[model samples]
Target: MIAMTALAGPPADTLWATSLRRWNALCWVLFAMMAVGLATMDGPAGSRYTALALLGSVVLCYAVLDRFPDNPAIRPHVYLSVLAVALGGLAYLRSNYAALFMVTLPHYWMFGRTPRASMGFLGLATVGTVAGSVLRQDGWTVEFFSETVVSTLIVVAVGVLIGLWAHSVVAQSTERARLIVELEQTQAQLSEAHQRQGAADERERLAREIHDTLAQGFASIIVLAEAARAGLDSDTARSAQQLRSIESTARENLAEARELVGSAHRPGQTAAGSVARTLRRTLNRFTEDTGLTVDAELTDLVCDQQTRIALLRCTQESLANVRKHARASTVGVVLTRQAHGVELEITDDGTGFVVEESTGFGLDGMRKRLAELGGRLTVTSSVGDGTRVLALIPMAFEAPGEGEAER
Candidate 1:
């Protein structure tokens, strides 16, 4: 029953609604054409007889058309019955030419929306034609029987072809619609994946900035303060006072770094006043006391608080490495926005070493910090060649609940 229903196509209710409208229009047109043909035809049996017969067939066809909208199988049987009556009436009138129209009636009737039902109608029509011709002739000669059989076969074949073509068209249309729906679903999934990937990237960048800047600076202040406390009894009282001042300043900077880091972790925190400006102030203070040429080129690039902190830390780490290892002339810091990300270049004409052979914690820590933020750090240096450290962080990375901000 399920297979049978599937073969019929769609639900019976929908098919009924669609087929009824079409059949109603077709029936009316068929009735009008038949009525005109009957009126004009002059017959020995009389025009009244032909008119009554065509009118009766028209009435029957209309009744069937109206009734079988909910049942497609019944429609073809109704059409076949009407054609049989018309063919029989024409044969009685000795109008063989008009009776030939009966052969083509099944062709149209059998090729309605349902192809399986139409094929059944085609078989019925073929049998009825052959049987009617034999019964009317009284004596079936080979010549007459062969002609009727051949004509019936031709009509059936044509109806079958029409039914197959209609089925093909409907199948193609259904498949195209299904494919379009699938394509739309796939596009939606891809868009969602891209959004998620962008968010993950941003979170990592924030993590890297925090580790490099605030964390490393606090460690340095702790070490320096302990040294000053231990050496206060010696003649290094001036150095102890200087170290005490450095400790106080480091504590102040630590408070600022904590606030910035908190804002980066928390969503919806306004980043208007907390950006490169704060970092620049800290760097300026460090340069003033140390007399280090901190050639800083910081931009007004707007980023999340966490990302800002990460970038600041990255800068601090690079500078710390410069102060510790790169003992040379001028040091240059360049921070610039790229097409898809940001780049920070720290160059110094210091005594360079083999990057592969060195197992320093500072460089390794820097690399690890950048990786968390979906960024990369590359160190380019050789013996006596000016050391250049380049860090690249993609703008695509965003923390959860945070969106990309313009630079």
Candidate 2:
């Protein structure tokens, strides 16, 4: 933690300013005491000289205190106590200038900075006032002592009030800073949640569109191919083989459409279904139509609905790309879960293209979707070499049966 320095910045409530004002008031009171000493003195030469000295002292003290408000060492109580003790002794020696002892009361205001220092100054001032009054032969009567005691009590009371007020100001400033930090953290969390919600909504919308359009179109194609196969003559073997190919393509498209819709609709619907099952079903349909062998190694690991869906989507899109562009005979899919997160790797021994040079919407869209879920997609490929796609997502598990299970 950084230590707070007096010169770091001014307190928001002008605490230092208030302190300076109190010091200035004390200086003026000291000047008043000097004026009283001068006006009441019996000798003109001594009175004028004392008044000039007191006036100069008051001016110098005020200048120093006012100019260095943020100085850690320049405490108000210390300055006032030194002034009071020195002047109190001088008044006692001059016996006739006893009225100058009134300058001690301002020491009460100085005690606001350090309680212990203020208490020490208060004790000194009380003692000096009594000694000066008595040494000046001011009758040392009960009435005189009573009056001095009353003045000391009043000054200490005022000092206590000012000290409490300063402490309260510091506490309020600390609380304000703490609250600001909490508010910023809350805002950041809210922004992330909003972004996640937006992506989820978009995925649902796209899934609905594909289900209504592409899925239905594939179903129609499958029905027509079946009708063609049934009506074809046995002699037209070549034509029948072509129709079977068309039927296989229609079935593959229908499976893909169903998987896309399932991913969007059942986002968090994790049950006994394993990643391997989902990947196999998707790859089988792809290979049946495209005749590309998919080699896969999938471990049994329970994942949350979102993680499973994201992994499945990564696999589907990757293999789809291989079929369309890789021109390779074999592809591989691997799934592994570690302490930190789950990883999905898809590699195709196809004719690979430069990752940076390839500008395909499918790859970019897959990356964006993963990123929204705090996952990342990395692609490594070049001309002639196989392309590899890796997806990694951080995992945080809730207790089984905690939230509404996805349908």
Candidate 3:
């Protein structure tokens, strides 16, 4: 009875707290009503104080809930049906608000006990209700007994059904709230994953651009600086020429870096100079700077501007790796025409790395550039042996005197 009234109105923080407050209030209020009503009435002390004694039983039952210890050896639900049965026995002595209180008392049974125990408690309350009605009567008759019993049974049946349905609704609402919380957590994790993936993709794009332009440019500068150092005392003109080359490479590197990151500056037209002559000059300058001997066989091959650029970039990257890691005194350079395509092979007799062990971004950049143009790179190396880099590009051969090549 107290548990039902314990439910709060709109002001309480939660339903459970309201129920507790209402339950505590109802127990004391019923005790006070019995105390005041019996005392004020023209009744014998036994009848007057006896009602307080009856209500005191209920107060004792409430004390179990009201002053429950923080950590209990036994669960509260285990004894709740026992408390309900005791309260029903006391409500029988006098027909107070406790009789009407039996209507919603099924809620506590349903909450604290299983279905069978709850049904059993309802039956107990029903018996108490019938007995209390019989006690209040002036005389006993079958007609009066049958009418009251049948009507009370009907009301109890309705109240039990309502309690079961209410419990079902609360259970479903709790489960739905749990599912909503899980879905929100999943969405937050998915959003964070997308953010991380986007960041990784941007980093990879920047790495490719840097490997192609800045890394190659820096390698050239190192070689030229070494050359200038060698020529400082012997030949001023050669040193001056090396310095000029260094400056030119730096400026070009800046321009390429800017363009790679999205600038309006595009690289100048390469068709104005023979691609063969440009490669030859770059290789000669590389040999002059490093004092490395080169036995070269060159042939004029026609290809698109993009192919030419890719080939140049690949060659620069390959040579840069050799200059940085190779301790070889002699290197091999070969460019030749296959039946339907061109191949550039650069081999060095230096300490080579195991192919499977090497995972440099420079190699990945070279592979990406070739893959873009339907070209391929093949590397062969083993520890203590020389490394060989081969770039093969399938392209239509342009005839001599053709002003521009098709992309």
Task: Give a tens-digit lDDT track for model 2, residues 1-407.
Answer: 01112222234578775765665566666666656565456556675666456545645665686578688887765567556665555555464444444443434433344556655666676567557657765666777667655655575566456544544555566677788889999899899999999998787658644543364446445644665666577547645754776766676667767876586577666664456566666666666555678787776556766667678767767776775588899988888766667788999888898888877666776677688789889999988998999998887543354223111
lDDT of 3 by residue, 1-87 (tens): 455432222224587676676765676576557555744465566755655565565555545655673446545454455445544
- For each candidate, the alpha-carbon lDDT, in order, equals 0.62, 0.64, 0.67
| Model 1: residue 140 alpha-carbon error in angstroms | 4.2
Error of 3 at 240 (Å): 2.5
Using TM-score as the measure, the top candidate is 3
Residue 96's lDDT in candidate 2? 42
Candidate 3 local lDDT, residue 188: 92
In model 2, the runs with Cα more than 4 Å from the true position are 1-44, 70-78, 86-112, 161-289, 292-407
TM-score each candidate. 0.46, 0.41, 0.56
Stretches of candidate 3 off by over 4 Å are 1-45, 56-87, 95-98, 106-124, 127-141, 198-210, 233-236, 251-358, 365-407
Better of 1 and 2 by TM-score: 1
lDDT of 3: 0.67
- Give me the displacement of residue 287 in model 1, in angstroms: 4.7
